[model samples]
Target: MKQPNEKPTLKTIAQVTGLAAATVSRALNDAADISASTKERVRLAARQVGYRPNRAGLRLRTGKTRVVALVLNIEDEILGIVSPLLSGVAEVLEASEYNLVVIPETPAGDPLKPVMDVINNGMADGIILTRTQPYDLRVKVLTDRDFPFVTYGRTDMKIKHPYIDFDNEAFAYESVRRLAALGRRNLALLAPPPHLMFHRHMSDGFRRGIRDFDCMEMPLGDIDLDTPLQEVFNRGRKHFLSTHRADGIVAGSASASVALLAGLEQAGATIQADFDMVAKEPARFTEWIRPEIIAINEDIRGSGIALARTVLSIAAGHPLQSLQQVLFPSD
Candidate 1:
């Protein structure tokens, strides 16, 4: 009895399920008073009628936007985080009532601007941010506001909030160990930006490994993972031209890794023949790009899933203590 041109609403779902409009609304919202059977029935009717909630109306009633914002540092395509991370976040969000919103912070401006914009505009109920600093202002601001947020990297801020961090320490330490075993005495790390929290972690591990494994440190000058690939390649080319440069390098990011390798090859240094490169595999390209490179896989997809889940849970008033996780890099 419904026109094909008509759109589906709560009333349409209620009619299909033979329930009151109020009951359908409560059930759709998963209110505690609603029975599970009734909720399931309402959901089934919603599916059958192709019903979708109006975001504006839902916000007015629940005082929640039911949106989570992902704040990313828009560096070069070097890290290759956008696609895999989004895929993982989207997979989790598809099962929930919330929606995903990406807020890109360009390298030019104040890093806190995107986060502040989300807060000021009430654009999202929660936030998930990446590229943390040792003394992160963003973490401090979010904590001070009592706003729900989850970081993809850890911070040195005194106020602890929810976070899921990749273990850069282990990644550096392990790469150094492997390279040392292969008799590579001089090593260098293409670290994250010196300002980032993980840079300290990675450098600490690199230094520790050098001391423990008796390897000499070959420092790369003023270059980092966040640097543009073209720049990285240029620096790498110049660096490798010197005969006394590092025999082993811990590659920083995926795109940067490729650039460095190309630079090394262009400088007439054979990869794994004259020197070796290691990386944290943001993607599986390490296997094909250079089979010899020891690219320890970092689960970017899994990190996305964890970040999304933690942010939503915290926004729902969950405590922060149990939500923190640090994932290790592995093959």
Candidate 2:
């Protein structure tokens, strides 16, 4: 009988099963050399003794920490979409022994430093990066080191890396096309920050929409992503008062849409009447304020799951294709 206060180890299980410690270890790990009968007996003995493998011992033996790191910028966290993304990652990892670690980056600090520390210090086996730029330095660093990593957005660089991104360009073009169909001749786009890679894609689509639909883009349509909510409203108000007031508007994000709504209300403009508006947002947010507004749902949770799976597969030496995926919203 095992003592209540005594913790069970390989030696304990071996003693209980009358087997050598090496044999017990091999059976527990399902080594091909261990026969089926012996493996079953060892497993039964381990269960009876309530034996569990020590994580530290396993790591020392396998040279794997079984931990993954997610590096995110403070700006992206402030957008309030990180929760769902994290939920998705957690859901996929819950069934496995691996754990998740988050490293935050400041606006002024070097974003690659945290990732490098995680790799050099053996803190994590894999990494997931968010808020990728067009010419991302982190990509080159990780690639050169042969470290396993996946990105949340695409980089403009020629190097092939695994990434999961929402189809922002297609969403923007479709939004403009819809507005044109409503007989809107002059359109405005409240674009994201200039530094983000997605900004370029959205801008390209907006410009294309203008030319294809024979519509004009408002001079004051482009708004920065970091602009405060009230400031966005103020800008919208001022734009409405201008001689070049737009007949339709497309907002970059849900928060921006809220501000635009406030401004429109103040300007005595009605939705689908004075002007039509379309916003790119999560499904829940669109549902919360629907009918009056049109929305393009961006599935961030799904993106998180894809990113987690890709990084884990890469870390495990799986020959996965350099995945570059872009998800589009439903019509």
Candidate 3:
């Protein structure tokens, strides 16, 4: 029996259940050599004694830290999207022994460095990468090392790996088509940083939509992701005040849409009357704010779940196809 001040260990449970310490350990770990009846007895004894497996001891035995690393850019962390994504990831990881560790990267620093450190040091069993570039070096390195990793976005590089990407191109194209249908000829698109791989997809979609709809794109509306929110709003206000004011706008994100709306309101521009706007955001946000503002629901939480599952699968030695998912707005 364990004293009141002593924490319950496998040895305590083994003594209480009259089983060998090695047998108790194997049963607790669900080793194939342990019979089901013995495993049940050991589990019951562990519950009675409140025995908990030591994580450090387990790592030493299995060579697996049982941790998952999620790497994100610090700038993107401020956008208020990380919460729901994290919630989804947590929901999936809670079902297993795995735990999540977040690693934030600065804009100027090498984002791949933290990922490499985690891999080389065996700090985590797998990794989840975000804000992927067109030719991401992290993807190349991880693939070369044959480490278990999954990306939140697609890469332009030829190396095929597990990934989950939202369809920015299709969303942009549809936003333009919807605006053009409303008889808005002069249009503008608020885009992300040009260095992002998704930016290429968004730009391509916007250009194709302009050609298809026979509309003009305001050159000044190209906003980068790194630009301050207030600056984005100020730029929109200035543009709307100019003689070349666009009659319609397509914002890449809800934050961009809000900034543009604030600018338009400051300039006394009426929505749907003087101008129209469409944005990509979580469906619930647009519903709660202004139902009239057309929005394409980007499922960030779903993407998180997919990323979690992919990395876990890779870690488990399960062969999987490279996953490419694109979500559209629901009516």
User: What are the models' TM-scores?
Assistant: 0.93, 0.81, 0.85
lDDT of 1 by residue, 211-286 (tens): 9999999977788877778888888888888766999999767777788888878888888888888888777886
Q: lDDT score of model 1?
A: 0.85
Top TM-score model: 1
Per-residue alpha-carbon lDDT of model 3 for 66-163, expressed as tens digits? 78999876564433467778887888876555779998887678877998889878888899998889999999999999888988888899897888
In model 2, which regions exceed 4 Å deviation?
A: 1-58, 74-79
lDDT of 2 by residue, 1-331 (tens): 4578989888998899899999998887656788989988987887777776776777899887778898876564333557778877877665444678888876568877998899778888899998788999999999999989999988899999889998889988999999999999799888877877888989899889999999998865546666767788888788777888888888878778878778877977777888888888865665565556787888878888888888888887867765778888764
Better-scoring candidate (TM-score), 1 or 2 = 1
Clashing pairs in 2: none
Q: Per-residue lDDT for 100 in model 1?
A: 90
Q: By the TM-score metric, which is better: model 1 or model 3?
A: 1
Model 3 CA lDDT for position 99? 78
Could you tell me the TM-score of candidate 1? 0.93
Worst 10 residues of 3 by lDDT: 72-81
Kindly report which residue stretches of model 3 are placed more than 4 angstroms away from their true locations once superposed.
1-53, 76-79
RMSD per candidate (Å) reads 2.2, 4.9, 3.9
